[model samples]
Target chain A: MKKLINQPEDAVKEELEGVAAAHGDRLRVHTAPNYIVRADAPVHGKVALVSGGGSGHEPMHGGFVGLGMLDAACPGEVFTSPTPDQVLEAAKAVNGGAGVLLIVKNYSGDVMNFEMAAELAEDEGIEVEQVVIDDDVAVKDSLYTAGRRGVGATVLAEKICGAAAEQRWPLPDVAGLCRKVNANARSMGVALTSCTVPTAGKPTFELADDEIELGIGIHGEPGRERRKLAPAHAIVETLATAVVKDLPFGRGDEVLAFVNGMGGTPLMELYVVYNELHTLLEGWGIAIGRNLIGSYMTSLDMAGCSITLLRLDDELTAFWDAPVNTTGLRWGV
Target chain B: MRDTVTQGGLTAWLRAFAAAVARDREELTDLDAAIGDADHGSNMDRGMQAVVGKLGGLSPDEAGVGVGALLKTVGMTLVSTVGGAAGPLYGSLFLDMGKAAGEDAELTVAQWATAVEAGVRGVQARGKAELGDKTMIDALAPAAEALSAAAACGLSLADALRRTAEAAAQGMKATTPLVARKGRASYLGERSAGHQDPGATSSWLLMQAAAEALASDAPPDRPRT
Candidate 1:
């Protein structure tokens, strides 16, 4: 029930204020509608990228708003999708003459809001394309649910697609690249503890000390099933197997492996999980062409990790290696 | 009984809906906590509070614009303030309703039915959800249908609205046993079945408020179970 905040309602705004103060050189924070944009936006000839969702997943959509990533991010209340007005305002602000691309996670709220924004932006004569990320393999059936929740691959897609946009890819091309990234990626997570959204003032869900929720989503929603707490190797096997088999990733396949922390999970544990993941992939004869190990996409302060494996082609690999600078991710720049 | 709801009655309906949301916020959140992230109650409460705030500030001249303008204002307020699926869904309901109602300051019962139907259509178009999806549509679609049927039968405004509210209540209860095929609750699979959908429950409250507020002159009905 305890959080370091002036008030529960101000959590998103206050954090955004801090982001503005700390990353002023790289980004600008707009209030009233609450969106973050690149400090030097309207990169006139480049296809601008806008991505957003609920506020709890730190650094994502917002921290990623800088060079070689998202041009803007619309942040909503914690675990709540940003409204269409926020998205529309962001799209309008960041739309370079080329066009704008909205990278949306596959949650219904995120989808509907972004869809509405796209419609609004289109009505205003802006060319807009939206790509939805649904890489989580936890949800079994798209027919029965809203579909798999977007997870770790969102970080990868933003980075790669941003690089593509920087390369002056057209709106459709950038949107296509984003969809390619999502289509080739699969992710799964497991949570050791539940997170407390500030407004709710309680844990989202309870986890017994001896159990873990496997295939968890980023929002602290319960996953596929709860199981007895097992060792790192065993847990990694369940997660990695679900991901690899879902895509039917085969021997000799190359991938960009991402091991992400869910807020409260320390880097130490993520690395441990990554190590096991590496060993498991090696056993399966899949080549790890590149790796990102961090808490890039987190679910507030929940103790868990999600592993995203993105099958890589030469194009994707090149994009991954592109020079990038953002508050959350930086390379070669 | 009046055959139409004036602009004032429409405004009262909104206030009543907002009050109902505030009263049931915790219960809605509890329902969501069982199957989805537990924010439905608070999110709706925040949106409705914003709605009431906007309603309170409307100048007398502005308030005379009509039911359509008032509903659009409410919809925009909800879309901006409510951050979840309900924001767009409920906002669409009101927005499309407003669009259908046009600039009319008063609407006959048949006109109200048509507007409600349009609003439900908007919800479907926005969410891409269908009936039996264990969504707000479960309650709202049936209510819209009942309203249309009552209107076709030449029922009084109060009688039609009462039937609409009853249909919505029945649909809301029906959601308890259905497996969710939409929204966050869908993630739970079979586990989502036993709980009543927070969205449908809220929609039921909305219809209930409409019956009460828009038909204030009618005799009181039996207490709800």
Candidate 2:
């Protein structure tokens, strides 16, 4: 309840104001609350890319908004799904004569909402295709009564999907590429401490001083289990072991290594987690072709991180290294 | 007591439900911030807004449309408007409710209980979570059970929902003692214990609101028993 802000209701609005002032040249606020899009997007001939989810995972759907990534991003309330109207508006704004592509996380809400928006868009005479990211390997798919939790590979998925769109690949082909990435990748996260939402001004859940959760989702939700806190190296070993076991990066496998912070955890710890992951992967004889580390996707401010490994084939390797430019990540531009 | 719930009552219930959530959005969000993601209130608000929008130009009798159409609409709205597990759970609940309603134009109180039972079934199907899992199912399942029991006793809508509300409150309280088995709180393991589930708490509120708004005209009862 206690936090520095004009008002609790105005936090998201004020944040959007700041974002607008900061990135007005390239982005514009959609009629839908919290939606942002390229000021001159869809170029009327390019594939429209729209992605969004809860607001706490900032610099994610929003930060990734720009050329070579997403054409628009819908920033919902913290840990909330953007309304279908917002998504529909984003889809319309970025349609640019080409069909729109919705990049969605695998969370039940995100998938369902995007599906609704796509339907709404279709009703409006626009074509909409969707790509859902379900790359997290922490919760067993069979145990998932909801669905797979989309995690870090979202960065890679959007990046590669953007590339395909930039090449003017049709919606079906672009969607296919996204599915391929999702199918090939696996991620697992753990948390040391619960993140405090600005609105709640408290941790979403309590984590004991001595305990750490393993296989967490992006929302600072609990992982599969809580265990005594282990050394950074041990944490990485656990994550690597889980990811490899589920996806099985073979002895000669080449992969993209993503050591992602849940939010509050620092780059230093992520590096520590990464160093251990690198060593463990080497031990397994799997090669890491590219590496990305940061709080690219996060819970409110949860203290923890997730590790993702995506085994790559020749096609994936090519797209993985393709050019991408956005607020969160940029390369080969 | 006669069936006091009417077509107008249905619309009124939804309107009041939306208003209540809008009024307490932050409290709901605050609860979620404590034990889950901080978006339950906002998500519910957004979904309610969509629900209200969809209700526009529709009659109360039409509101009792098939559970599939109603639930599909409600589920899609929640999915689009709400984020986190609460969305899917509640969405599934409505999906189930709609499925139970199954193309009926109007349902008596007993029919409504049957509809709710069906909704509960769908939620269990979707969540695979049971009572005491520290999910919304905790409060919802019990409330549905109580309503069904009260209906079987031939009570009017008022008495049935009174029991339903009582069950929901008890279910809400019961959530405090159990370790969470689902959603964000489940990740906290033992630490997840202590705090009441925000989703389950709100589910109680939803049922309470439903009973308060839907009950037919009847004399007030005596002290709690």
True contacts kept of 1: 0.89
Best by DockQ: 1
- Model 1 chain A: lowest-lDDT 10 consecutive positions: A215-224
lDDT, candidate 2, at A31: 43
List, residue by residue over A212-287, the lDDT tens digit for candidate 2.
9888777665567879998888888888898899877789999999988877888998898888888898998999
Q: Model 1: clashing residue pairs? A: none
TM-score of chain B of each: 0.94, 0.86
Q: Write the per-residue lDDT of candidate 2 for residues B101-179, one digit (tens) a residue.
A: 6665456778889888987887777666888778888888999999889888888787888899889889888888787
DockQ scores for all predicted structures: 0.78, 0.24
Find the candidate with the highest lDDT and give its number. Answer: 1
Candidate 1 lDDT, A170-287, residue by residue in tens: 9999999999999999999999999998978888888999999999889987788999999999999999999999998999999999999999988999999999999999999999
